[model samples]
Target: MTRMLLSVERDAIATAARRVMARCDELARMSSSTEGIERVYLSPEHARVNRLAAEWMREAGMSTRQDAAGNQIGRLEGAFGPEAPALMMGSHLDTVPDAGRFDGIVGVLMALEVVRMLRVPTADGSFRSPFPFALEVIAFSDEEGTRFGKALLGSSAVAGTWDAEWWNLTDEEGNTLREAFREFGLDPGRVGEAARRPEELVGYLEAHIEQGPQLDERGESLAVVSSIASARRFQLIVEGEARHAGGTPYDRRRDALLGASEAALAVERICSAEHHMVGTVGQLEAYPGAVNIVPGEAHLSLDLRGEFDGTRDAVWQLLTTEIDAIMGRRGLRWKAREIHAAPAVFCAPLLQDVVRAGILSTLPEGVDDPATIFSRAGHDGMAIGAITDVGMLFLRNPDGISHHPDESVSSGDVARGIQALAEAVLQLNADR
Candidate 1:
């Protein structure tokens, strides 16, 4: 393992990390929102970043192209040829509203750095691949689903899981996905061409920020991702009678807002008790703006996740029972509509070992093993896992805050992550 993950110079690591940081700053300026970052799917910002990423990938000695689904792809052919199975690495470029600079952005840039470090110059003044398999770095265009309410659109296309129904999905501006595709200079009819066959990929490895506080709390800079959590999202509605707030007696009134609030609390309580389970009520709204009227309808969004599917579903069942009881006591009715669901994507054992070895290579003399974690946040791997084996490395984020402007990663961690991920790629080559 140590032989596979050869030591990288500290200066090289720092230089790669600085380039990544500077690129991140450049991308931050290409946002849709004036106040904070808001680059969404197929937007002008997305186009700009794709062009920029392609330029950087070219500088790293890879030929670049944009896929039919709008994903930016850069390919460095191996000794076998252009058709050879390739090791793929990348993450999404799209971000949630008011997003952090280092969520998915860092992964794409790190992959570019890895390619830069590995690409060899030939006598003909052309770049040559150092390994038997090619290296492909991708910048997925729509992993956040910020514009169209469907996450992983870019990765799903690459995984050959593109849904035709998604063509009708509309953005906030009422532009259909089909229209948006054409407007972005892509032919929707050709989107299927973007899908890659399983034989084309050796495997996929991604490096991303932790998006949580576990590594920080442990005083660690990086971790091996064991798995990504299974997630389910729902829009819950609570219905009750609308009546005069002042005239109705306490016992006679049915308050939907209060019932929904109680159910939200129940979600938190139940999930907290279950290991690796988490539930959040991120959105809530009550109908009837008048203060004098009892709220007849309340809507809330529930985001539930767990390490395993069974445990996550079981917790949801328990929450349903508890919510039923609460609504019964409040004389309100409740219903839930599942908005999105994804099964957990576990890292392949081979890739996990490689990533672990990579992390160990960057550790001090006395350290033996790297920390392992299950990601609570979703990633493009969840979609790409349908086609090929997937693995991930995680860098620490302070306080575990994500999807906000305050989301941050340290320069030292970024340097370490670049070395670790590059070493992981080399380790993979050796293992092969």
Candidate 2:
């Protein structure tokens, strides 16, 4: 199918981009933290953003609702009526601790702008859609999983993959997820109702800041996502003998902390040698309180990722072998408990083509091709991919800094992104 030209004007794109930036600033102020943005699932901040998003959806000429899982949804029915399949677009509204304002918020706002441009105006104070499939924009309630330590809680329900055991998960304050649902004014028993059948959705498209420096390093504004990373998380524990630091000589000491430190370095060395693979030891703790005491135990968290599942596992194996040698030489016994694992999710070729055409439409003359990059970060699409096809567009983030206050994207880039996404929707219609 041929790509379609965008009908949206330059002024409209600029206006929408400005509006998105303004809304992002507005939402950033609603954070629980005085220091930086920190909105989590089932909190008062979540409710506040959902209400604000609903208002924007109505202004864009769509009917809005909050699903049983607390995800915010807005729908514009096609010519075939309400039951018709929908072209879905959106991203999560949740944020990690000390998050920047534009990570997921911009994607949800961009989806709204795309709908505003596509919905046809009628003389009778009503609107109509030219496409055969309905259009939906979602602001998912949870994606960062900061509260319960389980990511994709909102999208998992929508994908019909919600694990019943998740209801028992608790936060740092000892509040269970079941209680949080009731506190949020949602019935836990009805969460199953949030599931959407695969047939009801045509496909999913999301626009987000790159969260990395790939685009910025290459002097490009945007790129089409090729796939999301495969990931595995583990808690590693190292055990050794506890003894008096003052009396024990260096040759006689069996320090667990030293063993764990060596293992962490080994992780960096092993992962760096592999292509598209990365390992991070984000947290480390040593037992014993006093500065004079020798530590008997050490615990560290490992987060490993790669572009492919097989290669990711291979790197894990190599890491384990290196860690075993390090621990054995240090006279420490170590163990690793696997906590989480997810395979890489590739984008559909059809969706990739349309997204490429969308990015190309925004470029200057003679710039016909767009860059393609694999996302090292996890997204809602990882869970949503269980039910439907997914595609993503990435806007450049300066210095690749994310999850912090310094993260940023230019207003010009946001305007171009809005036009590109609108063009993508029109191209999808033409393909249909």
Clashing pairs for predicted structure model 1, backbone only: none
Model 1, 326-420: lDDT tens digits are: 99998899999999999999999999999998888888778869899999999999988998999999999999999999999888888888888
How close is every model to the real structure, measured as TM-score? 0.98, 0.98
Model 2 spans with C-alpha error above 4 angstroms: 1-8
Q: Give lDDT tens digits, candidate 2, residues 52-104.
A: 99999999999999999999999998989998999989999999999999999
Q: Where in model 1 is the C-alpha error above 4 Å?
A: 2-8
Error of 2 at 45 (Å): 0.4
lDDT scores in order: 0.92, 0.92
